[model samples]
Target: MNIAKNMEAIFVAAIVIASATSFATAAVRAPEVITVKAEATEMPTVTITAKRLTAEEKAAL
Candidate 1:
């Protein structure tokens, strides 16, 4: 029974240590920055011409 209790304590200590180590390493590590360069291009221009239909043209249709 004492040995079993000692093993349980060891297991819990191991888990706590592992969690603390992970947190410490994460806090100590620095983040990486990635940069991308893209070329800018001009878009093509579009022109549209529209005429309103007269009353006579509507009647013809």
Candidate 2:
């Protein structure tokens, strides 16, 4: 009788452990990756020159 009771206790403990592990394995989350995105606050722009640099200064650069 004592052996039967001990076996029943172990069986219940194993079933509880297995159920907890199955729940834990099934509740897995996907790996998260960090993504960096810049918000475009404004569009591209262009500017025209009214006065140009000297030829020697441009060539020296």
Candidate 3:
């Protein structure tokens, strides 16, 4: 009876210690943010022109 109570107290103490240890080891780290900028430059663009062949050109083919 008394021994069982002591064993229960020890078990609870062990669980509490284990939990505290884990929490200490798993401490949260501060987050860091980094920013970068580039000198803006004009982006290149391409232009394409297309024309359909006439009926005469198609007949020659």
Point to the candidate with the largest lDDT. Answer: 2
**Cα lDDT listed for each candidate:** 0.88, 0.90, 0.88
After superposition of all CA atoms, the RMSD between model 1 and the true structure is 11.8
User: On residues 1-61, what C-alpha lDDT tens digit does candidate 2 reach at each position?
Assistant: 6877699899999999999999998979878999999899998899887888899989999
RMSD of each: 11.8, 15.0, 13.2
Query: Which residue pairs clash within candidate 1?
Result: none
Q: What's the true lDDT of residue 44 in model 2?
A: 85
Model 2, residue 36: distance off in Å is 26
Positional deviation of 57 in candidate 3, in angstroms? Answer: 99
TM-score of each: 0.39, 0.39, 0.38
The regions of model 1 sitting more than 4 angstroms off are: 30-61
lDDT score, residue 2, model 2?
80
